[model samples]
Target chain A: MTADQTAAWAEQAIAEAAHEPGSAHPSREEQVLLRIERARRRRPKVREERITLAHGAGGKATRTLIDAVFVDAFRNPALEPLGDGAVLDVNGGRLVFTTDSYVVSPLFFPGGDIGDLAVNGTVNDLAVCGARPLYLSAGFILEEGFPVADLRRITASMAAAAAHAGVTIVTGDTKVVQRGRGDGCYVTTSGVGVLEREITLGEPMVRPGDAVIVSGPIGEHGITIMIARGELDIEADLASDTAALHDIVATLLDAVPVRMLRDATRGGVATVLNEVAQAAQVSVVIEEPAIPVRPVVTGACELLGLDPLYVACEGRFVAVVDGDHADAAVAALRGHPLGEGAAVVGVVEADPAGLVLLKTAFGGTRIVDVLVGDPLPRIC
Target chain B: MLASQIRELCEPGRQYTFMEVCGGHTHTIYKHGLEDYLPEAVTLVHGPGCPVCVIPMGRVDDAIDLARRPGVIMTSFGDMMRVPGGQGSFLDAKAAGADIRMVYSPLDALKIARMNPDRTVVFMAIGFETTAPSTAMTVLRAAAEGLSNFFVFCNHVTIIPAIKAILDSPDQRLDGFIGPGHVSTVIGCRPYEFIAREYGKPLVCAGFEPLDILQSIHMLLRQLADGRADVENQYTRVVPWDGNRTALDVISRVMEVRPFFEWRGLGFISQSALRMREAYAAYDAEVLFDVPGVRVADPKACQCGEVLKGVLKPWECKVFGTACTPETPIGTCMVSSEGACAAYYNFGRFTRSRHKETSRT
Candidate 1:
């Protein structure tokens, strides 16, 4: 049918829904059609029909688009409050399952590649949910003209990352698209983990007096990837901080009463903190001096006019613990190999709830807002 | 110096308005929350320094037109992708099957041209002096290498003319100017002397760091307190008085100042923009392609023109938070993150509301 015919049919259905055999006493078919019409009207109309790069920017636009389409279509209690993953109760045991797709350009970077990033990303999602990641599923979509050597390197990296994280890739699938359809390859991974302890970790557990601790320095992974593209023409020893964080989480759990655990992924630490603040209805005040950022990362961010706080980190996670146990938490995190740079960066506050603020070294506080679109490189 | 010390320096009874004429400075001020420590009398007015934000809709439409060609590869700094044209944006065009790519530098566009021999690579060269020199160098390199496929859609603007336009405006009441550090690095402290000599507004060239901005503000206030209205350099490490002579020479050789150029918010200003010199006309995308050089007006509801002149604050605009948000921006000020409106909406709206409440009381 033509576009006009389809529209006419839809209009007829809606009209029938409005006027039935008996206007006062409608039939069951009429009631069903009326419900359908209401649902159709309630559906959101996105301004743009096609997806743009901003949809993946991990910002306000991304959230709106996700809520309008995916959340609306797959409406359920489990997925209602979007976190890193869904915590499902299987046979009276808590299980956390999460999935992420890796479509980063310049597949290979100084520290990691699409393969390792895919593995670490999924593992971190499950690990941050106060769970012990167990297994992962790898699915790849490769372009027809993609090199086999690159594919092998990515798969090997994934395997190495999985092994380091103590997780197995139980099942896998691969498909090849037409030459121009895909950018080399895209990897989508699903991770499953078991909740080892009875601790209930999330926004509910987050309190006003909680202390925020970061695993390491910020902006490494993002800057490394940008530099790897060979666009900036600046050389730095900076590399992606892509690592497995299950061990660090486990160690920190034993040392302190952790309230909330979150892996700073796509939107970086800023997004994660903003999510926590909004979800818990508490303000997060971070000290700029207390935050650890490598000089190289700072230089790169300075050149491009990008902020380190809003950049992505693959390996890092933020742990919020009760103020009483703040020191213990930092010590525990620092003792771990992945958390050597761990520091008490911020504190949860009562006022200005649902906002993240940074206490600048200049004795001023700035709002550490969520990432809005990609960090566009600028010369000035 | 601490921001608190600077805050103490701000005269409480009188409102001291300081305009930062660089987008990077605007970003730093908002991102670092430097405005929070300021006394109620001090206000930091964001200026028209964001190149991505000020590229009029007509230029973007022309870019999209050039991008839509069969074997054309349109390259630009990533910030320009989301900026709306008359129809939509470069992102929208890319989604609709345009070979648009984001580059960190003009050299990257040159590289793409080198890699794709058969494709015509067009770099949407935008920004102030900081970026113009690189574009000029790229053109010179293209010529040296005999790369006929490379072209530059030169939208590179001169900051001094734009600054002069702001200073000359009737409503411009800025006490001092926080000069753009990077732009000054290319065309140094010498050009900004006009502001102090002619308008008696102190211009302090500043770095992008939080501390750098705070110090610059402090320096400006010192000048205000001592009654010295002259151009000062706070970003002495990067920008010298004479500027980068080599880069300026390259820019002068390959490009020429346009007689008149239309700014999105500031309207038409003479010598406000740059174009390829006759010697490099063969590498100019505007002459080679059939782009409709149309003059599209800003949206009627948008108060960006007033905002650019520091006449109206970003939040004071009618459509600021409601219609003109970062997600769906209707005006040039809301397009790029570096834009004044976008910066306020993204990172400073909460503080802005608090300031509003304090001012009301």
Candidate 2:
């Protein structure tokens, strides 16, 4: 068939397939055409009229929302991929810019509050982009009824976290919303960091045979927040893993070769792995036994039917490193207090590119897809 | 036994089809990739135990209506927040300025009612017997506390009647059953004895763990290989043979089985649902709100009825992915996480690409 004929035929088949049932018998060309057409049609759309909680689930729905609305409206080379941070080129050097909003219910959680989260979250975002921790701008939206004492506590936390991360709070803004119009407080932080080192790393650098290493145990931050919200009514000695990762990242970079690094923040390590796999066109196969999870977090996740991999990790990150240097990288990370529980969790593969699979502890393999909606506690 | 050993014990030449009757089991099977442990000769079918999926659309519309009412706060489990109604989901209602809140448990709704004495709190009670007792206890507490504004829109379903209907259906081909662990914890294995005695099908009450599921599958395989059929408790740690008597008593006192209830895709099944008893009528949201009890027909393109009955696979439905999906579901089966279609779409899509995978209709 001619190119025009093929395109017309493909378009017709796709339109018909949307309205009609599958054909029992078709030509080989027609089958291929239908498969490709279906794949294109299944791409997520951000056409909803209003924002629902699903839009903020940090899952497929969230990705669709961001892509269709924000990314479509603000199309730029820096803002195209929608990574945690935008890597920008400026006069023979690179800078990483990223912003995140914290509106977690129960702003105060074990081990950290929204203030601690805001500082560490943005710093880690830029730190993962292979940037030197530099500066942050904090914006606070406070409710009319919010207590000044609470604000003082949060600001203190932010100051402590910034000082620990060696980043300056260069500028900030505060606004007060009407009563009942907001949660107690919401903090948004924008981070700017410069790339000083010659070493290069990113999702595109990941390749087949690269090793996947997690900085520490996963799911602590998510579970702690969930418990703090008084939803499950379960008790365990669990605390959020909210800490800066620049020190650990630097240590790993200096000791062994690294490909990509991402702090498992909103959507957890599973999401980071999926992004890396898709960017590099490689498959990520993670060993369930090798993934580090605290016992209490595991117990809570089991009760709530939440996957530890999908749970948020404020201080944890997944690093893709050269296979030969994985051991050394893990050793270097483990030497740091924040990365004490570092482990080699998975490896990239050539087959089934752009997919993440888990080798279960029971010796069976399953796809580790991105999180769907927010994980809810199931009765069973 | 390990999943590998369970696989080895399966009969090699013949196909054995076992149906998992709980959404939790379906979720576990998909989440832990337990399906990979099943031998090629065995096929597992998902059943309609998902309370959220079986909640008819008209009821959801009523919930949205009630949520939008002045001085009324409609509460529901987080799972029910995203389920689509004729207009939209509870989440959409909330987005549109409705007082719809997601409560972790029914007791939380009662507490909200107590705190906000001026507002009426309507809890959308959902789930099987596993969750029914909690709602019942909450209602009892509300009654004792004289909380007149606290109400329950009961949609609690009983599992056995639905299971019996599936067995009586013309398309019934299930060789065995993997019963819900949580429901069995409440009603016990006694409720499932009829399947073994009358239908001659083995029923294994299983837990929601990957290892527990593998063990249950092994038990079912043993029953098939030895030509024996009986109710076996694989989750002995939690579920006793007679079940929790205290919970059953509380349920019996506060609620009664409805003579007929409309299951979303399975049609009307007798004694398959629960409603607040007459003594607790004051606490019933349906009566307080004058709910129409309207029946909404399933979408024409949705084959969830056949899928629930195991007569058709999810992918076999004409609109499985094209018109029906988790993002914009046309069918209830696609909305709930535990629903068979959602499970397949989320965890089993890869199975469709593997030529060796077997799914019998």
Best by TM-score: 2
How far in Å is the alpha carbon of A319 misplaced in model 2? 0.9
Find the candidate with the highest DockQ and give its number. 2
Q: Candidate 2 DockQ category?
A: acceptable
List, residue by residue over B1-361, the lDDT tens digit for candidate 1: 3657877776768789999999988988887676766776888999989888778877888899999999999999878988876678888899889999988888999999999999999999999998999999999999999999999999999998888998888888889999999998988899989789988889999998887888888999999988899899999999999999999999999999999988988888999999999889899998898667866667666788889888888866655554455656777788777899888766775565443232122
Q: How close is every model to the real structure, measured as TM-score?
A: 0.87, 0.91
TM-score of only chain B in every candidate structure? 0.96, 0.96
Q: Compute the interface RMSD for candidate 2.
A: 12.3
* CA displacement after TM-score superposition, residue B121 of candidate 2 (Å): 1.0
Q: In model 1, which residue pairs have backbone atoms overlapping below 3 Å?
A: none
Model 1 agreement with the true structure over A1-380: per-residue lDDT tens digits:
11111112223323443343323332443343233224222333356768887779887658768889999889998897687889999999999999999999899988889999999999999988888999999999999989999999999999999999999999989999998899999999999999979888887789899999899998899989888877678899988999888889999988989888888877788888988887788888888899999999998898887888888899999889999999988888888888899999989988676778776775555567665578776555
lDDT of 2 at A198: 82
User: Residue A69's C-alpha lDDT in candidate 1?
Assistant: 90
